[model samples]
Target: MMERVHVLVVAAGRGSRAGEGLPKQYRVLAGRPVLARTLEAFVDRDDVAGVATVIHADDRALYDGAAAGLAGRDRLAAPVTGGATRQDSVRAGLDALAARGAEPDDIVLIHDGARPFAMAELVARAIAAAARFGAAVPGCAVFDTVKAVDASGRITGTPDRSGLRAVQTPQSFRFGLIREAHGRAVAEGRHDLTDDAAVAEFAGHAVTVFEGDPANTKITTSSDLQAAELRLQTALLDVRTGQGFDVHSFVEGDHVWLGGVKIPHTRKLSGHSDADVVLHALTDALLATIGDGDIGSHFPPSDMQWKGASSDRFLRHAVERVRARGGVIANINATIVCEAPRIGPHREAMQKRIAEIAGIGPDRVGITAGTSERMGFTGREEGIVAWGLATVRLPVTAD
Candidate 1:
């Protein structure tokens, strides 16, 4: 039997050094919260079975808002309130997992919530090393000369640079070993340990090191955050625009669904799905942006699985495809062409629904309604039409 893999994300630090009024982990990085991105790195992986986050007792509301848009919230344990120090927080998180029935043999990766750039390949290496040696951490080879400095900033003896490695997080270890190490440290009044690897070493466990990515940086200051943003900008140099148009004919019904919003109408739109014209168009637009064919290519009308399905599922799938390609949906602008149902009262709700489905802020989603000058099917109240324009930012890859 394979042991389960769990993750502990320590995020209780005040992060005063980051120069942010809010906790640095809760600060916005790129477009989403920093902690959300960190959680996503683990949440999207199939190898990760569960995740637990340790946060300060006073930061419940902040944590809630930061994690509101993440899809992996269901995989998270009810967040454990952390202690005064990072070590204490990790212990608290481990305790929470144990209480939730984590076995002694299970593997746990302790990661920093501020380090959002950890890649899946790095995590895989850490897990492999831990499984082989019971303790491991990802580290990068030091490239610059090392010099020791005294308290007065005087130069001391230089250490051998060839033997130095800059260690990173998602430090993996067996559950029993790390728990015992943490318990021993508390019993011995040793609270000055800097990282989990140090704790294991103090407990007499030999830890192995695996190769780490240079981009897996911890955000400690404002300059670091700016640099991360610049890196993201460089990677996302390819911007593309896609347009989609959808039309649905009228049917005998009391209401109609548009952009996931149900409005009372004299008639309804007819299709295999809920016939949400707005969402259908937006989904197609997103698919086109990613060059993933159209909505019909994914959910065919001939397939009974999508019969009377909610169009929101299609929209969500499109967004997931964008993320799978290391791209972000910059904006979605949709226009509803109808003459009967007054879209004015429900425009805000429509935008909010689109944002939720796209995993972005509502401000980035735009919705408007207009008519076809009483000339087309929409003007005649025979059907509704929707036009969508999607702007996407995708990572540039070498062709």
Candidate 2:
């Protein structure tokens, strides 16, 4: 049977070391509070049964605002007000969960609120380990040379860093074991602690460690924050941001046209097809969304099959490929981003055209316009460049 999960996130740190005006957990990183990232890491996982956050009483406003924009925000259990020391605060959190009727044997992940970079797979690993071994935590191999230094700043013998390790949060446990461990630690007057491992060890329970992501570093000192920023940036680079530029230079021919239909212009566009850039880019984007080949692969440039063919036909064909695989357009937000003819007046018409070609609702088709302040080829009015995002949802069964 699957263990009922009640992940307890501890976010009451005052963050005196970072020296920010607000608590470190509430501080904004990558447009959301640090704690929001941690909560989302839990909410995104299908195995996480529930979540309980322990925060400073005064931080309710910050918490609410930060958690607003994330999907599945309702999964967060009600806030528990924390106590003086870290251990006291943890006891208060556990009590709050018990007050909320969390079962004794359910697993609880006691994660540091400041560590926001834990990935979904890491969370799953902790849960699986907890189920098998009774407790687990993500840890990285120690890199620096360990040493036992004296109070007088004299060097002691250098110790081996190979066997040493640095532990990170999302520490997993059998709920009853952790609660009992904390209670015993309090009774024994053992208060010098920084992590749940110490408490569990004192209670005579065996704990296991697994390989952790190097990116999962706790945000404490200013240098740590910088390191976190670098990791976050690295992760975000996977979004595959691309600025696509396509321009059909004016050629000696008939009246000019763009976006499938004819628009009054001085000269016609020269391309293998009707040269509707908006539609072509949208077709390519649909292909990109599915991780298939590009637009050129589906319709080669040299093929007379598409010569002078309406660009709408190309987009419609791409839509069919997605539909054949049981995929539908979730949303398509695009920008014309040019300085040629005014796109504002034709924006709605463009949306209508794209909706028909994409086989999606007009509401799902979005368009925005911007000029480059006369900086590049687009600013010089040489051509129009467009950028867009197409989000697709994978097929899934209801639980």
Candidate 3:
């Protein structure tokens, strides 16, 4: 039989513990939403066939807002409404899958949306064990000593920790088996199971333990969020960077385009097209890093068709070029130099224009003014000068 597995993401928690005023799954970690990063891990893995997230019925706005800007949003299965308890939410998720004609015996991995740090190894191990045992859970052997406490908070007795292990999810299972397990529990009027593994055990199923990453801790408190943020920041640091620089001198024209915006200037860059130096340089740098051809190759200035073209189109074309090569813009730092028409007043507008055209945020694109110290052509007001450095996230390639 063909293997087609789907993940059930339980994100309906109100997160009373974390106290971040947002659901634990929706909390902002670093610059991205917590659950977005969680979903990305599996979505990037080719082994996962599908994904379905469970959320509170009333959190539609929050869910949509967070889901936007994610790398692979189309692959995400429609979210199902969750219930009061975590067990209820899981059952609801199963029902949603059943309505879609999912097979009972098919593989399904149930994961906590709060545990964004769950590594690919843990996922692989759980899937491996589940395929063999019908059910598999992730855990680490209990390391510290344990004690049984009384109502007065005094140690009533000491318990052995040698045989105990703390389990984590995504707990993998045969979909048909887990659905039946939940149905049986509801019929039995019992609903207090801690995790999916416990539910399977109650249904006479054996769940094997696979070693899990210690970093895969649930986000229950502020400290947990802080730790997750730190891990995510470290991951973001390895992001790729690309650089570009372009210069254009004064030509007899009515207007000049800077960063995709037309500005009133006595002289425009001398080119066959509306030579926007800022956009041209940024585009050249972006394409340069991806090994894509320069603007001359894509839209040659020698061609009359590009004459008087809006610089916005040039920027958009450049952005599409980068995305086509599976890379993303990290940051853009561009400098504009000229003796006339101060660039300070237009800095914010230029940055906004660049960000919009580049498909990035205003924060990711920056603009600075440069003077030739009244010594060079720019200082003499004979021409204008512009340069840009574009940093992009280019996927690693095997040489």
Residues forming the 10-long window of minimal summed lDDT in candidate 2:
236-245
For candidate 2, lDDT tens digit of each residue in 250-281?
56655544555566665566789887777777
State candidate 2's TM-score: 0.60
lDDT score, candidate 3, position 345: 79
Candidate 1: stretches off by over 4 Å: 1-3, 56-81, 155-157, 250-255, 264-268
Task: Rank the candidate models, highest TM-score first.
Answer: 1, 3, 2
- Using Cα atoms with residue i matched to residue i, what is each candidate's TM-score against the true structure? 0.87, 0.60, 0.68
Which candidate number maximizes TM-score?
Answer: 1
Q: Give the per-residue lDDT digits (tens) of candidate 3, residues 149-193.
A: 999999988778888888999999999999999999889987999
Ranking by lDDT: 1, 3, 2
Candidate with more favorable, higher lDDT: 1 or 2: 1
Q: Rate the local accuracy (lDDT) of all candidates.
A: 0.89, 0.73, 0.78
